[model samples]
Target: MKRFHVHVSVENLDKSVQFYSTLFGQAPSVVKADYAKWMLDDPRINFAISRRGETVGVDHLGLQVDSEEELLDLRSRLEVADIGFRVESQIGCCYARSNKHWTTDPAGVAWETYHTLGSIPTFHAREEKTSTAACCASDSGQAGTFNTRRETTRAKHCC
Candidate 1:
């Protein structure tokens, strides 16, 4: 099975959490000082929010799979599209450890396909100053950097 994922950067975490909780009719499953996540079964979406000093809007969209096989299946589909994507194995981000394939759609909207391996203590293992770390979508949703070499960018922490 797979769950739809949506990550958004917000100006105010508390306010955003309050609004979303009310809208969703439930509190988030995971709450941290700088981030919160709603593992909603009703809609089967991994909706997350963060105050990570990034643009205040939808950051990126993704598909979170349940097993490695499912992830590989998704990756194969991406490869068939030939749009180009980068793979990160056992990477830590969004307070979880995952293996991800990062890419951008035709309009430059960032897309991530991943399988969560486990949970982590921090948002990411460490801060990266380089551009070849993770993918981030700006407010325009088209200012994302895609280093073809690694297919990653650290414009902001990945979901």
Candidate 2:
């Protein structure tokens, strides 16, 4: 089954984790030093949060598919719906080898639908710099300017 995923940026990771755990009536499935994620079965949501300065809202929203075929199917459906998407493959952002379809909603919130192919390699400044440049080139027309701060934060924390 597909899961609706939401990643939020929070000022305090511990506080947010406690609040969300209470709200969801369960603890998170994954927790790192600066991040937490809950794989909620009842609502089928993959909710994640990262501690990043003072930001306290959605970083991005997305759908997580089970396979590459499902990801392609979603891309096809988006095309049929007359929606434009920016696609990326094997891009090392948010700590994974994700094939993602990026787009903005009517309200202008960025959305990413992705299937993570594998974990990203260890942190390498040159490699990350290259990936960031490539991702910008890919999404320039679709998302306008990529928020470098947020992208860098994701690279450091979420990965």
Candidate 3:
């Protein structure tokens, strides 16, 4: 099975966490200084929030699969849909190790399909000291108007 994922960027992490916890009727499963996550099973959504300096709104949407096979299945469907997509192998982020496939909806909303393998100590858990440049290596313009070679702006979200 796969769970829906939503990452939202907020100005106040503490307030946002409190709001979400009350709204969800439960506390976040993981809470960091700058990030918090609620692994809710009732709605099966991997909801996360961060204190990144992005627009205070929905950051990105995603589908979190339980295994590589499920992740590949989603990837295959995206390929068959003829939409441009990019895959990052074992690119760790969000305090977990995950392989991700990224694409943008027609409305310029970014979508990620990933299978998180395990937890990591750092938010950007990659081999070597991951430069902000390498962590968000989106292919071409499929991932919206970001990750261009000239623009080394790191993703505003926690991941």
Candidate 4:
């Protein structure tokens, strides 16, 4: 199974949480001081909000798969499409550990396909020494825009 994932960067955590909880008709399944997540079976979506990014809007979009096989299948499809992507294995972000394949769309929207491996203690677990440019590394070694904590413009988000 796969769940559609939407991550938004918000200005106020409490207000956004309140609004989204009311909109979803339920409290988020997980709430942190800087983040909240709602796993809605009705819509089959994994919606998350955070106050951790410089931009306060839709940060990135993704598909969360249930198993490694499904994740690999998605990767195969992306590869077949000939789109450049960056892979992060067992990386921790959004209070979870996941294996992610990240790519940017035509309009520069970041798209991630991943399988969560487990929970983590922090929003982003890796401590990269390099500055975040603006995106992930593409096949041309140029910066491509994705929300993962790659070496770019210091925008902090998760997969």
Candidate 1 stretches with Cα past 4 Å from truth are 127-154
Question: Which candidate model has the greater lDDT, 3 or 4?
Answer: 4
Q: What is the lDDT of candidate 2?
A: 0.66
Q: Can you write out model 4's per-residue Cα lDDT over 53-151, one digit (the tens) per residue? A: 668998888999999999999989877877766777777788888888877777767778889999988766653545332222323222233334333
On residues 77-124, what C-alpha lDDT tens digit does candidate 2 reach at each position? 877777766676665544456777776666666677888777544322
Q: Estimated TM-score per prediction? A: 0.83, 0.72, 0.83, 0.83
- The TM-score of predicted model 4 comes to 0.83
List model 3 lDDT by residue over 26-88, tens digit each. Answer: 999999876799999999999998765457798778899999999989988987777666677
Worst 10 residues of 4 by lDDT: 133-142
Off-target runs (Cα >4 Å) in candidate 4 are: 126-155
> Candidate 3: global Cα-lDDT?
0.74
- Considering only N, C-alpha and C atoms within 3 Å, which residue pairs clash in candidate 2? none
| Candidate 1 lDDT over residue span 1-159, tens digit each | 999999898999999999999999999999998889999999999999988735788878899999999998998887676656767787778788888887877766678888999988877756455433333322222213444432333356477
The Cα RMSD of model 3 versus the native structure comes to 4.2
The superposed Cα distance between candidate 3 and the true structure at residue 19, in angstroms, equals: 0.5
